[model samples]
Target: MEPIVILTLLAAMIILLLILGAPFKSFKWIGTGAVRLLIGALFLFFLNTFGGIFEYHLPINLFTASVSGFLGVPGIVALIFLDMMVVN
Candidate 1:
């Protein structure tokens, strides 16, 4: 994309946020969500690392991260199920 188009889209996004009147609050939620994503990723990393000892490893990528991030513990469980039922 052109720089002008990028700027326009960015400006439009900012304007929309301002119109919504909760930009800062939304950013707070974004920050919290980002933290959750990181935590979930780290949890999966540790799980994969430890499972390596047992010759079981879960693939870590955007899909898994999003799953774990959005769904929390249930997401981890689902990944485990996938690993056991599908990958294995």
Candidate 2:
């Protein structure tokens, strides 16, 4: 689809939601998930920065971010383990 068409549809949806008043619970859940994803990405960024010294680098993408965000430190460790044992 065209960019303009997608934007128009998105705008219409937003306006409709505003008029209809979206559920507070859903918004809260979405906000929490978004924050977690951001935190997860930050974790990966720091890891890459320091791990670079050890030649350790993990791609920052949706799957990794989600795992780290939702599962926290253990998730990062697991990814590292997988990278070392499987990828190599």
Candidate 3:
């Protein structure tokens, strides 16, 4: 797309959002979910890093991250158990 066209569309979107007001609830939900996902990723990273000595690992992806993020430690344990069952 042309730069001018993109700029115009961006400006229009900003104006529309400003006129309608931002959705605080949606933003809060999204922000919370994003933070959880980040935390989940960190959990997995540490798990993999430390668990490496024990020869354990779990793939870091959306579903796993969501499960771990929303469910916390239990989620990671569940993933490990599930991986064991599936892989073996």
Model 1, residue 57: displacement in angstroms? 0.9
**Candidates in descending TM-score order:** 2, 3, 1
Clashing pairs in 3: none
- Against the true structure, candidate 2 has what lDDT? 0.78
Indicate the TM-score of model 1. 0.63
What is the TM-score of each predicted model, taking all chains together? 0.63, 0.72, 0.71
Scored by CA lDDT, what does every candidate get? 0.71, 0.78, 0.77
TM-score of model number 2: 0.72
Where is model 2 more than 4 Å wrong at Cα? Answer: 1-23
User: Which is superior by lDDT, 2 or 3?
Assistant: 2
Q: What does candidate 1's lDDT look like per residue over 1-88, in tens digits? A: 7645644664565455446644576586765555556556666876776788998777777788778878988999998998789877
Cα error of candidate 1 at position 73, Å: 2.8
> Candidate 2 — which pairs collide?
none
Global Cα RMSD, each model: 10.2, 8.6, 10.7
| Residue-pair clashes per candidate | 0, 0, 0
